[model samples]
Target: MAWLWLVLGGLFEVGFTTCLRNVDGFRHVGWTLGFLASVSLSMLLLEVAARSIPMGTAYAVWTGIGALGTVLTGIWLYGEPATPVRLLLVVGAVACIAGLKLTAGS
Candidate 1:
């Protein structure tokens, strides 16, 4: 359950970060609101997940998910370059995240 919450929080973190680009430095009201809402929910879920999961593992996994998701979304939606090195690094990060999860004691 805590892992689920952490994953969801990470997803929301991705959403919020994507929204940040659309926010135009907070000058756009709608995007700003979206960013605020997503960030708030992401934080809330992360806090809930932290109640049960080890702090270091939880934070690492959460950030890993967010970072990977943000990068992929940027490449797909915003036309960011998907360089081989970047993709390889993302895969490496994914492996590390999985390793952390597998070793984490529930």
Candidate 2:
């Protein structure tokens, strides 16, 4: 359950960041609101997950998911380049995230 919360938090972390990209320095009202909402939910979920998960593990997984998702979102939605090296690094990040999950003490 905590892991689920963590994952959801992480995904929301992605949502907030993606929304931020469209926020135009907080000038865009709709995107700014979206960012605010997503970030709030993300933080709430993270807190719930942290109740059981080790702090370091929870933080790493959360950040890892956000980072991975953000990169993919950039590539697919924003038309960012998917160079071989970048792809390989993303895969490595995924592996590291998985490793952290597998070895989490909680």
Candidate 3:
């Protein structure tokens, strides 16, 4: 259940971050509302996930997913640089998140 919340939180994190790109520096009201709502839902889900997951582990996983998703979206949708080095760094982040999850005994 807690893990489910973590997943949902990660999804919402991605949603909010993606919406942020459409906000046009907070000029778009609809995008702004979507961003705020998504962020709020993400935070609330994170709080729920913290009940059973260690704070450090949960936080790392949440942020890892969010960062990875955002960077991938940027590369795919915004034509950001997808250098080999950057890709490796993203892989490393994923490995660390996995390690934390495994070792945290969740």
Candidate 4:
């Protein structure tokens, strides 16, 4: 359950970050509102997940998921750069997130 919350939080974090790019420096009311709402929800879920998980581990996983998701979304939707180097970096981030989780377990 906690892990589920953490994943949801990560997803929302990605949502907010992507929406922020569309916000045009907050000039777009709809995008700004969506961004704010997603961020708020992400924070709430993160807090809930933190109750059972170590703060550092939870934070690392949350940020890793959000970053990887956001970059992938950008690449798919906005046609952002998707070079091999970028893909490798995303894989590394996933490895780090997995390492953190494994370490936390022991």
User: Each candidate's TM vs. the true structure?
Assistant: 0.97, 0.97, 0.93, 0.94
lDDT of 1 by residue, 1-106 (tens): 9999999999999999999999987999999999999999998999999999888999999999999999999999999999999999999999999998998896
- After TM-score superposition, what is the CA distance of residue 23 in candidate 4 from its true location, in Å? 0.9
lDDT of each: 0.94, 0.96, 0.92, 0.94
Pick by TM-score: 1 or 3, better one:
1
Instruction: Using lDDT as the measure, name the better of candidate 1 and candidate 3.
Output: 1
Q: Write the per-residue lDDT of candidate 3 for residues 1-106, one digit (tens) a residue.
A: 8888997899899989999999999999999999999999999999999999999889888998899999999999999999999999999998988888789887
lDDT, residue 38, model 2? 94
- lDDT (Cα, tens digit) per residue for candidate 4, span 1-106: 8888998999999999999999998999999999999999999999999999999999999999999999999999999999999999999999998898789862
Candidate 3, residue 88: the lDDT equals 99
lDDT of 3 at 55: 91
Quality of model 2 by C-alpha lDDT = 0.96
Q: For model 2, which pairs clash?
A: none
Candidate 2 vs candidate 4, TM-score winner: 2
Provide the clash count, candidate 2.
0
Off by over 4 Å in 3: none
Arrange candidates by lDDT, descending: 2, 1, 4, 3
